[model samples]
Target: MGCSACLWLLLSLGCVWGMGRRARETVLGTLGKATMLRIPPELQNLTLHCGEAMWKRDTEDPQRKLVLLKYSGGNYTNFMQGRNRFHKLDFSLEILNTSRQDRQLYEYVVSKASEEEVWQIQLEVYEPVSHPSIQILSRVLANGSCAVTLNCTTERGDNVSYNWASQDLSTSGLCSHNGSLLHLSYSLQDASIACACTASNPISSRVVTFNSSECNYEHGGGAGLRTEQLVLLVVVPIVTVVVIIGVFVVARLAMPRASPEQEHSSLAEDGTLHTIYSQVQRVESPKKDPTTVYAKVMMPMV
Candidate 1:
């Protein structure tokens, strides 16, 4: 039968059996964790006196029963699947290694002396949230104001919602949008702000913090530079100057040099010089044209 028809039938049975009370509850369970569905204190006595207690799942197959407990003549009997994973203690149910498939609507039925009591519970199972991480999407500096965009995400989480908050709650400059995507704009003169991103589900939560000053550096536009970049800027030019000076000194030392006296002595010993009165006579060349004349040279005393 359909779920609605099954619910109608259950309601009809409760009415005909003179149901005493009905209670509704919601329980949250984390994946792979144990959770307890407890019977209210006021209903514990009624459950103990009940002749039959059943835990049924509300689904297309309304006859699907998860657990059944019967008490007769001071003896108790129970039926369920996965005996190792589920336990009943004083009418309370404990589930271990919960999974997403365990999320469902369940009904606890108790019958005693021709009266019935029902507790309808809705189970919501969620994966525990992992540590959230922040990614800087973009950063801009315009007119002394810095605008940064960030995205908050988790590696593993189910049914998680994101919330952003500032470490300093009194700060008026903090702003965020789009839940997981945060956009913040602040003046450079403002104090550095720390932002926290929380990823939470019904069962678990995780938070991550980021400093706005991390994105304050602008590579081409802003005047601010990271510490390492500033160190490079200062140390690189000094290193270049030292290298240039060393190279100039090495080049100067590699060249050959001579003293003034040594230069003069070398020129004299080569004998490539003559005095003005060294040539005394000129003779005509007989083997050549008569007009051609040659001079007879003589070396002057040094």
Candidate 2:
């Protein structure tokens, strides 16, 4: 009987558990059927770092104050429909509704308010500032002549004005107006010149300076010729020396040394008949025709 009783108790608990789970699912499904209005995605992810509440004095009463609320983050729109008010006396957030949904929304709204009295809070907002960067496209060379173009660009700020000035007194072509760019085709007689650019507006001002070293210029006529001349001076002499050495090596290899026997034979063939005829005339003491003896000896050799 005890075991049967235990079995009945277990069955009853199982049924109760199943019914509770089914009821939970039904409630979730009903809530899911309701349309959910999402706050702006930017607002939902915003974090309010600080806020301020200024009380503007009414013109009629002077004693009654009108609330002027200013906040840093975009999440401030979330509290537009909520019935929450900032208490001046205590500087606290107070909710006017007691419903669960109202309470949840109010809690989220109040969390954005400042805990301190004076709301000088810093917030992460999409407020982009214009930061202008300047680059000098052309630069002065060592020869003291230059033509430069100025580039003015901003990451966020538009409608910028550019004013260019050289710190060197001798340089010319200063710009007086502001625009996206200022091109100055000027010449300077000084070395290491610097040009500054100023971008200004009614709210803020920014200045950037470009040094002569950072700018690049095209090689001009005289400069290009000088470079070529220098290269030739360095390279031509080296090539000429190489050619002379190569010629000397080839001549040494082709030159022939004369043997003593060949030199003697050449001398004999040139002067032997003349010497023999002169000797024969002197020995014979008569200048007879030497052609007879020459022809006899030459015929035997032939």
Candidate 3:
């Protein structure tokens, strides 16, 4: 009877050893396949939440371990449950032994959850900076025949809408939002105006203004009108006076002069006038010699 009992005990020991080896091989073999690795969704975030539970193991004893809990994303503490619950709990099923081979599996689970959480945080932060920027496209002149365009561009917002308003009474137009640009066109008169653009999202709002100067021709009339009138008044009269003076100077220099003879002829034609003219002509003519003389007495003495 003693021998039989010893034999049964040996057989049982062998069976238990075989089973443990098989379980280790199975787990390791699945890891080697790469495709068979299973990761729990809950363990994805490497960061732990407050009061989150984790399995902790004793550095000296491989079998003795306890649950460690986290109170926040970073804070961790021992899981101190009542004895009744702690004793019945199984650590083997919850905690896998940390080994060089388990690193990939652990990282894979944590990375997925962490990525999702990070994306959510980024989206929340982006909401406030998503407002659009307003740009002055063009403006009309004072003639009231021209139209001006204003553009509103969204910087980071999605599905953005725009509102535009002008302070000028003479201007009237509608605002249309297309993608990232807002367009507005209006007929301009001589008036000062202010334009504003409001960009809105479901969570936030922003506004921008394009204020026109009081002297801006596209808006309305102001002190600029008086300045223009003064320039025209001062310049036009000076130009007209200069042109009149130039015309008088040119006419005086270009007139023809009468000769002295023509003036005398126009006065009268009489015999005394003829005799005076004839005597003057005679005095002005070249004179001729009265007679010629010659002597030949020197040749007879030689």
C-alpha RMSD by candidate, in order: 12.7, 23.3, 23.7
lDDT at 42, model 1: 46
lDDT of 1 by residue, 73-157 (tens): 3455656445213234466666666777778787777776577788888889888898877776678888888888777888898
Best by TM-score: 1
What's the TM for model 1? 0.60
lDDT, candidate 1, at 228:
55
Q: By summed lDDT, which 10 consecutive residues of candidate 2 come out lowest?
A: 22-31
- Badly placed stretches (over 4 Å) of model 3 are 1-127, 130-133, 139-143, 154-161, 165-183, 201-203, 213-302
Q: Give the number of colliding residue pairs in candidate 2.
A: 4
The lDDT per prediction is: 0.69, 0.43, 0.40
What TM-score would every model get versus the actual structure? 0.60, 0.28, 0.26
Q: 1-302, model 2: which lDDT tens digit per residue?
A: 69978765654443333221211000100111221112222222222222322311122444553333334333222242354454333333333432223211111121222232222211111212365676444444455556665676656533345666766666544544456566664445445655666766533567766565323532222235456767799888999999999999999999997799989876766653432332234456466654333332332211
TM-score of 3: 0.26
Question: Of the pair 1 and 2, which is ahead by lDDT?
Answer: 1
Better of 1 and 3 by lDDT: 1
User: How should the candidates be ordered by lDDT, best one leading?
Assistant: 1, 2, 3
